[model samples]
Target: MKVLLFFGLLAIALADNTRFEGEKVFRVKPVLDEHVTLIKDLAKSIEVDFWSPENAEQVTAGTDVDIRVPAIYLDLVYTMLQQSEMEHEVLIEDVQRAVDGQADTGPSPRAHSYTKYNTWSVIESWIDSIASSNANLVSKQSIGNTYEGRTMTILKLGKKSSSSKPAIFLDCGIHAREWISPAFCQWFVNEALTTYGSDAQMTSLLDQMDVFVLPVFNVDGYHYTHTNNRMWRKTRSRKSGSSCIGADPNRNFDAGWCTLGASSNPCSDTYCGATPESEIEVKNVANFIRKNKSVIKAYLTIHSYSQLLLFPYSYTYDLAATHNELMSIAEGASSALRSLYGTRYTSGPGATTIYPAAGGSDDWAYDLGVKYSFTFELRDTGRYGFLLPESQIKPTCEETMLAVKYIAAYVQKNLY
Candidate 1:
């Protein structure tokens, strides 16, 4: 029996070891400060799944680069960068070989099923099933049409009141490669429904506040992620006479529109778009938020693999008008999240947290007087990045619940 069990486990491991075997790691150091921008501009050659400054205090020897990227095009990407004579070394060979050896080995393990890179259809089906079972699901009339005409879905959870209720608007999957973002949205819905009557805080909060979640903010980019490259970020809008496709939807928001941290080049990752809200997906959400700005006291835009909790003023280094209050709330939420598993997450302004990004939804939301606007960068710091394993989903969602509830509870209590 032990022999049989051993073989069974071996088979499962073998089946789940479908990682990037042909890929190679590049331990690169920047010759110029704009080296990252150059590589990002040529993202087609060498793909970067994760990129960050090795700012962690706990640094290992030969790990100063401090980025973990998992992709099939690593070798080709390395070749392209090598041509540029960038100083680099191979940090870790066969990283995923170590990954599967350490990751979850249980029944229905995420490293197993989710490794297949499940499509939007699979996730959409799950959303449909959950919404059908829950009574509080209220979808808005489609705010606008996408470039491809996929109907953008916005779900409002909690029971409807006879009168208006202060709302919290949440959106995710603005950048396509961040698949984990959309998963959190779905998880948030499931929790809200499953815990409605079971959890008092959730019940009372939902009873008072309407939570509007647009599971996938960039529907076209999301669809592109499922169909094409796994690391594709930005929208999927095609510009006339320009070969480049898509704009950074975050850079297309109305506030500060695209004054800084944005690109005039259409192919750039931070292209501000032809105009503010040019991308229909951004337009849709912007219009929806505009129409309901009065009630949206708290706004959250979810992204992944950074382990960050960021608030507004990303376009510039300027502190928000309600900086003190926003900082207080963010600190409390981050502290609550860490209490669970000691999961490490940094809390700060968006510009300081990662990079200064213009036209982001958080900034726009805050400018619109949704002063409690925030952005949650979810899951493992770099181990998984955007390709975070499914097994980690529950834990990520579970720990995140504390922070979310902390914010939700605070918002509900402060309501006039």
Candidate 2:
């Protein structure tokens, strides 16, 4: 039995290794109509993975576009760029080298470290341990199962109260490749537990409100990223008739239902599900939020590769009803975050700040009456992209903690 178990774990470890040998990431500065059209045309011509500005549709004049090109297309991409007269630079030369350099060392069975990017199994174990260890202030709840049958666990953090307290629903890793997102969630949980008594603000917030932390929102996709592909970004559900494996959970919400900045085609990275909440993972979360609507005063979803603090209404160009207030809080949080390590985060409604991404969780949460809903795009704007180094985990989480605490402090004080 022990021998069998050992072999099983070995197989899992071997499968988790992903190598991206000769791939290159490029940053293109599209400054004209022709440049933007070229980017769109290039995407259609080949499998160009847009890292920044999200999709080819968002590739507008004067915007910086980041894209990952396969080894086979590198020469073609370079030649086309030269002919088109578009200004561009290589951000990453050898993706596998970057991936190898991202981590400090080879994998070891050391106890889970918040500063390290743990595998899904390690995170799962850490979740169990942390929740069990801090039972008084943190309790675990399995909201549902992922498409691949992994349990979706949420940790509720706060002092136990006689009655239900107004809460904040915080989730991370909605897009699997954004590893730093889940790291922040875990860090937030640790901070809330470790600082409760000594930190007056944290104590007061806990005394007054609850925080629900879904450490990894898209469990299946996240696991897949660790096991199969380092850049996989959607849920891991297979459609009966389609070959596509997943839907973009972030783009699977019901706010605007795939109208803008999203694709109906299953093969797209930003493919909205066949319908809103079509992904079981999204449905489970939406159902939980809907059931707890009366108490969930704020919704915070974390993503990465752009340093932005965004609020609702990404589905349309129209501003959110609480746009000004949301902007103020986001700016304040951004400022707080900047004070630590000088990281600057642009703050505004999602549509104007970034692009018109429909069916986002923040938008759906806001429309569901969670007025303080916000989405955080964390870490370096594009240097690392989704493959942010593990060494950065500490500082990233440290700075983000300030912004999150700022939001939590504001939510606590403003709760009616």
Stretches of candidate 1 exceeding 4 Å from the true structure = 1-21, 24-50, 53-118, 136-141
lDDT of 1 at 167: 90
Per-model TM against the reference: 0.79, 0.95
Off by over 4 Å in 2: 1-18
Show the colliding residue pairs in model 1: 46-77
Give the alpha carbon lDDT tens digit for every residue of 1-416 in model 2.
12222222322111222567798999999898988877787777667778987788877898899998877667677777777778999999888888778788666544687887777888899999998998899889999999989999999999998899999999999999999999999889998999999999999988889999999999998888877888888998999899777999989999899898999889888999888899999999999999999999999999997999999889999988888899899999999999989998999988888889999999999999998999999988888888899889999999999999999999988987
What lDDT is obtained when candidate 2 is compared to the true structure? 0.88
lDDT of each: 0.71, 0.88
Clashes of 2: 0
Sliding window of 10 residues with minimal summed lDDT for model 1: 8-17
Identify the leading candidate in terms of lDDT.
Answer: 2
